[model samples]
Target: MNCRRLNIINRNSQRLLFLVNQLLDFKKVEQNGFTVQFSRQNVTNLVTAVAERFAPSIEQMGGKLVVEQCERDIEADVDAEALTKLVSNLLNNARKYMKDRIVIACHADEGQGWFTISVSDNGVGISRDNQEKIFKPFFQVMDDNRESKGGTGLGLSIVQSVVEAHKGEIKVESSLGNGATFIVTLPLRQEGVTASAGNDIMSPAEDKGCSRAIDGGVNDVSRPVMLIVDDNEEMLQFITSNFNSDYEVVTAVNGKEALDKLSRHEVALIVSDWMMPVMNGVELCRAVRSNCNYSHIPFILLTAKTDNYSKIEGLNCGADAYVEKPFSVNYLEARIHNLVEMRKLLREKFSQTPLEPINTIAPNPVDDQFLTQLTNIIEENFSNPELSVDFLANRMGISRSGLYAKIKTLANVTPNELIQLTRLKKAAKLLAENKYRINEICYMVGFNSSSYFSKCFQRQFGIKPGEFTPHSL
Candidate 1:
């Protein structure tokens, strides 16, 4: 197991795995199990990461590989895993036939709402007749002078399947002796998701079950606010119409507008589209989770990306659930209801164990940090009888009402109750230690009145302080 031999084995293993994956993918297509799972992806990043994977091998083979730099990030709703395969297959084919160089470029047309990715190589170009037949399964160009390049010959066919599944088109430009370029054009967003551009327009068909126009704000303050964000006006309308009876539906065209709405209203949950201009869904989810004020609200990502990778990424970003496109209305409603009910159950659980690590309750680092800071403040001032909610809010650099709202939302308890709970939990630990007298333990934990402390302690732990034993803990 020398270093060089190990490296060679590793490289070969990777190549073999790649080939096997390709074969499996093509098999899936043949069996009609190949599905495109679309999500909001940065086109430039996807292209760069995928093309760079092949760059080293191509350069090692003495071929110059150039991935053109885009001026700005181009984002689109696309099946990332499938697109990765398509780029890899094209690059692999080019590497096998390239004389010296290969080039990859991406361009977007904002007006037409489409983007194109082109891969070109200075290889033995396909003939006019062969170009038409190249994407067929197991079809390969046979030439007399060139060495036989080994492959399953299903690369172009898989690429075509990926493109067609995404409702896009792919074309090839090539002639004998000249280089060949494969150009793939896909929509910036999927069809049926037209850009609203901050407008709230809906078709007659879309307006069938809706009563009022979506005004991009809270509809009824009496109901729990649920923010619905999407670039498609029709989608916003559809969701709002369905949830309006039970929720104060707030609509936004994109993530930026959604954040604005969140700032103004107390949202119970969020249902956001993955792809949009200004900001995307994953970015929004991260932002919400990082903000202590909104972190407790359950988030559901509405996307066409049903792939396991996309679902994991979405959930990792703090989304409570991921709903795929063309999803059933009943299923989406159920997911939303379950997530909201789950949050309420968590609140009840946290309320029962107020001294528990807040991170365990919220499961978000930012929320944990905020809760820990609050807990630390309370613990430090436990001996001071003057400690109050207003003092705590001032120390925490938040307004009194804001602190109350946040604590209520996260802990399901008032700020004053939280302070008392912290003191009682410490008292219980001291009692369990059996080193302090009952009155001493009460005073040590910040209770001036021993009788009052015992009453509160008994109320919390369900036993009189004098009868408390380690076993009761």
Candidate 2:
């Protein structure tokens, strides 16, 4: 075959593949939902790259690619990857439908905290009736001599989705005989701490340092630690800014990174993105649950995947909460505080509650057996005031660390907590039966101090032992 003819065939194949890729990309956004990870980016450089990429192709089709003399380097909080795709899709539509030339332009209005990008083509324009439906997925325009063309109608739909993900707007200005211009306007930054304005310019790689320590500041060991996981750097910074006052915020780019951080840090809670490059949130949740040390940490998955199936899967994977993207900052702060408080309550409850009797208490059979054996040993040593982790470890034929790992994995509570919980349950039962006075019950259940017993009981069940009579029980 002639080389020119073969090249033409190759071009067609590339276009088909492009369509397939676009379809897959859009489907993922639709099914899993999308969260725009924002950062400071040069809109001009991004658009220029896209234009240069297709310039040769446009030239081959008897057209020229012109980047207009608009604000060339507008820097703002934008998801560069999504913006790249959006601009590429618009360029592709222009290449396919109208024009001897394609033009790209951008403007930034910092006063209004907004920015805009417009792509125009002088090709065969769209009719007013058709313009209304152009951005709908797979809606191709019909025109004179429109036959013998290969195109996926997904281009504009993808453009629209990207715009919406950034909390932006998109519209078309066109007439049948006139040309078409697709313009996109986006906020320079989202309002208040759910997202922070990034730097004036950025590279493809993000700084991973912000999550652990910022500006090389010494680590504050006194503050409670929180793990913020999201692929977007701006979001991580934003979340950190909001939580830094109350908690020591550490950042991670994805689930895998978060897991690595957990291996090293005593994180109190985790807020993660559902979809990310390395490992997504659900996988991280499952991994965290399976781990002995990290299982007890509260997990909140912040994602755009709000579909029922996705939400259920996230919850099933061990996420304590599911927060959708474009989420309210107030709601997120409240939710985080709530999860932390709930976690404290849960651990206290685990320390006090009976873990045996699978049908009644334990959820899994393995846990039931483990708890049954552990509780039996506790009962055997119930009267010993010297009962401690070292004593329990020796009795169980495991090291202290091994015991901690086992109990944490099983009940998301420490072995010491389990022992305390066992004793509390015994004391509560004795009190409920009115078989012993509060002092006697405390000593009998291995508690040295009746006052301490009262405090623990109040914390576990919201009632003082003296006030929690048989009738109350």
Candidate 3:
């Protein structure tokens, strides 16, 4: 084909694909709900309809599209449009790039409460290097060469996003010269899930669960106010965006302003920076803790300080948590959720408690000594991921086994767990105050994955990180 003819063909093809993709995308979004109507017949008809639509395209590309037969009809609680888009994207990719044959398969196991639909293509396979990048937005490996097909590069990204939105996962397996296979797994619809009508697909119960998870059950009217302290405009904007959805977020530029805000407002949580002028986080924490009125309110310190001494000092100075810098949005959100939940729960507990007579509480001398020593160790090597039992023991001139035993005896937990717990708790506070995202919070707290950070948060608090933020209140 001439250059002009090829260009014309490419444009026409892209336009057609774009229209089809948009229609499918719209359908998925529109039909997604807690209860969707799909019987075995419906699934079959839908699959057949999609296959027929793509068959001509596949034939034009000299590729055969084969649909593998399953033993029984598969009915799933899924948006048909979403599923169709996923399947169609996979098929289109295979047909466009694959060398010869494409296989589309669906499997249903009612006993397992899960169904899987997969598309396998025998084409010029994707390299390992490009597999992960393929799902990212506007990323195309085959750019403008003759062999390079036409696409806007949004297909796979959209597919992944839609799947994740539906609470599902997409997995890809490919090797250079070996074709790629894409698998999508979804929850099978049984009688348990309520089927609801309207474009708002999630059931009332699911919505409640999501709301409860993202926002702690603080009544909107009674939710404690929060004051955010940050100097960077971008950081402040990001923080505000994350919290404005649920909380009445107020921002301050520095510790001095933070104190000023606290004086004027009944702030439930104070999130301040460690490096701010006029007063740093330690100074702010000390100031707040010293005052009887603000002492009860939880204080969270955000800083780039990874040193153990810094964290310990912040915690010791009445800061509820100390989140480190360079955190993820999700991790930060999770942490915020955690602190909010804790604050709400504590408020409830305190409200229910009978007033106690004034009494002097003695400080534990042993705890002070231990905390001092721990601070020294953490300060010495906060950057070391393996700064755990072996490292601490080595530093203290003791054996690994002995150090582990001693730490357990003193702290009632493993040394590593304690360290991680401390890091996560601090991270959670930063998150609740909308200081960072989950991923940033993960790194800030010395974690590698937002998912891992979330798991750790759940383990520590018996709730997901998202549930810590007060949504209603």
Model 3, position 250: C-alpha lDDT score: 87
Query: How high is the CA lDDT of each candidate model?
Result: 0.78, 0.72, 0.62
TM-score of 2: 0.43
Weakest lDDT window of 10 consecutive positions for candidate 2: 208-217
lDDT of 2: 0.72
The TM-score of predicted model 3 comes to 0.36
TM-scores for all candidates: the values are: 0.51, 0.43, 0.36
Q: What TM-score would you give candidate 1 relative to the actual structure?
A: 0.51
Where model 1 places Cα greater than 4 Å from the true spot, the runs are: 1-222, 353-355, 469-473
The sequence of per-residue lDDT tens digits that candidate 3 reaches over residues 1-473 is: 46567446644754675656555554564466222344233455456557766765577678788888888777666666456666667777777778878888888777877778888887767888888799876677672253567666667877786576556778888886778899987767544343532223233433321121212222233434778887654456556654553456889888788888877776766777787667777887787766533554557788879998877887888776778765544566777779656545543332222121001110123333444566467544556767777777767665665545434323334556546545654665676687777778777766777787787666555567666663411
Clashes of each: 0, 5, 32
Q: After superposing candidate 2 on the true structure, give the runs of residues whose Cα lies further than 4 Å from its correct spot.
A: 1-221, 344-376, 384-386, 393-421, 434-444, 447-468
lDDT of model 3 at residue 264?
71
Highest lDDT: give the candidate number. Answer: 1
- Give the lowest summed-lDDT range of ten residues in model 3: 354-363
lDDT of 2 by residue, 1-473 (tens): 66577457646665666777788877887897666777666677677666766777788899988887663577777787788789889998888866698888888888988999998999779888888888887788876876624577888888888898899999999987678999999998754323332222333224221111101122223656889998765567556655664577888998888889987776777889887878998999888877645665678898877799998998888788899876655689889778655544544445434332312334334445556777888978988777788888887676777677556534555566667667777777787788778899888888788787787776655568887764563
Sorted by lDDT, highest first, which candidate order results? 1, 2, 3
lDDT of 1: 0.78
Q: Which one is best on TM-score? A: 1
